[model samples]
Target: MKRWDAILTIDKLAAELIAENNYKGKIYATGSPAFDKFRDIDVAKERKRLRKKFGLSENVFVVFYAGAATPAGWQEDEITFKFLAEAMRKLQKKHPEAVFIAHQHPRDEKLGRYQKLAPDLKYFDISKFLPAGRQGKIDDTLLPMMDTVVGMYATNLIHACYLRISGVSILLPNAGGKRLFENLSLDDFPTKGRKNFSHLPKKPPPSRRPMRLKKN
Candidate 1:
């Protein structure tokens, strides 16, 4: 920790932690440079443009599932996928304008498993639209186009929060799930609305429905 002349962090809390650890380096909480593109642009205009480029109408309600790499014994992924699939199915039936799309983690090899599990859900590969140099940074372009972002514990949720887009975190009934929420303090972050987090049961309830989005 002492080797570097300076350290940069995404937020003040992280900068404080580095300073408290007896680090001698200078600290800067300049937020993530990955989000620098979000600073000056007009969000409403950009969102419209991006949605059009992606073939989504302004009236369409888009829900984005941000998939994460899940190792063995981490049951959150399976639970979330099933829950979202069911909920989205119900939502789309009632609101034909609602659309569900997903992006899998580059390292998640079980992509086919989930796709088979939720055959109704559509997957979008943002890399196809991005230039090779920017392919790795899909969140910058993909997230703004979503009306809501859903995930188990992906950092993309934080990006959604910064963009003031609705973010939903599915909590599993296990210690791993508890620890992740405690470490991230996701509940502490302000969201677009109150119904951002969803607590799932061992089996998804047929009566349970996802939050409804108001059209722009």
Candidate 2:
């Protein structure tokens, strides 16, 4: 491994995975290339197009959720999805104009859950809205349009930070979990294997305001 060229990691999780595998190499955590790829996009135009495609208003508060790509047997992820959908339903009463959009894990393996869950909730799915091969564009566009993002641990959070979108991690509770809340950081993630929901924000937190990256 040392003889190979430099190892580039997209984010901290990738670096951690490599380290856990005991690969001692020159790993550069250079961030997501996807971020750089679509950084210069005309966001307003993309926002308009997406809203039109989803039948949503331009000024609606958009909450986007990112799902995982796992087997249908992954019960934990399914539970989390249900919990989030219910929470969003409760939130919609407060902001009727708010739109909830679900961005399935890009691999397409976990898209079925959305088909089953989105209709009753009246949420839109990014996979259904964007054409094939447009995942990068969707990320670049929707991350900026979203008011707050709810998802489990995923690289979407890194992109959210790149766009300064507020991301809330949904944690599974311990024991016979009845509720859950937004855990802002990795350290705040709850223990695995139970249902939970609580303390959700009606809008994006102040800390999530789009960042202005200054030159060093």
Candidate 3:
């Protein structure tokens, strides 16, 4: 693309970003995906069906941790998994009926420490259940149904936030250590019914360039 659109405080960030890095393109901030909430994916019947296939009980409290296994820049093996798995293990004592269902990214389920914890701990490779095209929407469906959704560094959290859900806990485990973006904190969130950041430049009405962008 000629000029890529940015998101959040990206316009200002782009100034410093462009100064340090060599690049060329228009940069503008696009808004958040949180507010654009859609209906949760339909999987209730299917989950029950799968449960029957596995001989699992009907009262299972499905806890799903499905997202990028090795999402981009973050070190996957260390921080994100470490804290999450540990937290779940600790959280399990109270929720004995809980059945932790994780969809391993890149087909690697059944990893370290996870294999040892008997019946309650289980790994689910969702790729088998969801077709490639429909996988993302599945995350949207499964998250809200959980007893509590707690994860670090995953896009599905955006959907969870959109639902304005309570009781779900989020743990941002950054190993290298940097603040992460929250739905409320990001410039994309609304303020007093107005946009959190700058308003969109109104379209030019068949005349001159936008008044804000025009120098004259």
Top candidate when judged by TM-score against the true structure: 1
Tens digits of per-residue lDDT for model 3, 89-151: 766777766677654444334353333433345454444556677552354555545544545
- What ranges in model 2 sit over 4 Å off? 1-32, 38-55, 108-111, 115-119, 125-129, 132-141, 174-216
lDDT of 1 by residue, 83-200 (tens): 7788888888898778776666666666465667777755555556677785334555567888999888777787787788999987654533643543333333334322433352
How well is each residue in 1-216 modelled by candidate 2, as lDDT tens digits? 435466887777677866665566677889755767555666567768767776778888898877763553246566778878788878887777777777666554644566586466766555556677776235545666777777766667767766666888765662112122222322233333212334344334568545799999
Give the TM-score (vs. native) of candidate 2.
0.55
Residue 71, candidate 1: alpha-carbon lDDT: 68
lDDT values for all models? 0.68, 0.62, 0.47
Clashing pairs in 1: none
Q: What's the lDDT for candidate 3?
A: 0.47
Candidate 1 lDDT score at position 121: 57
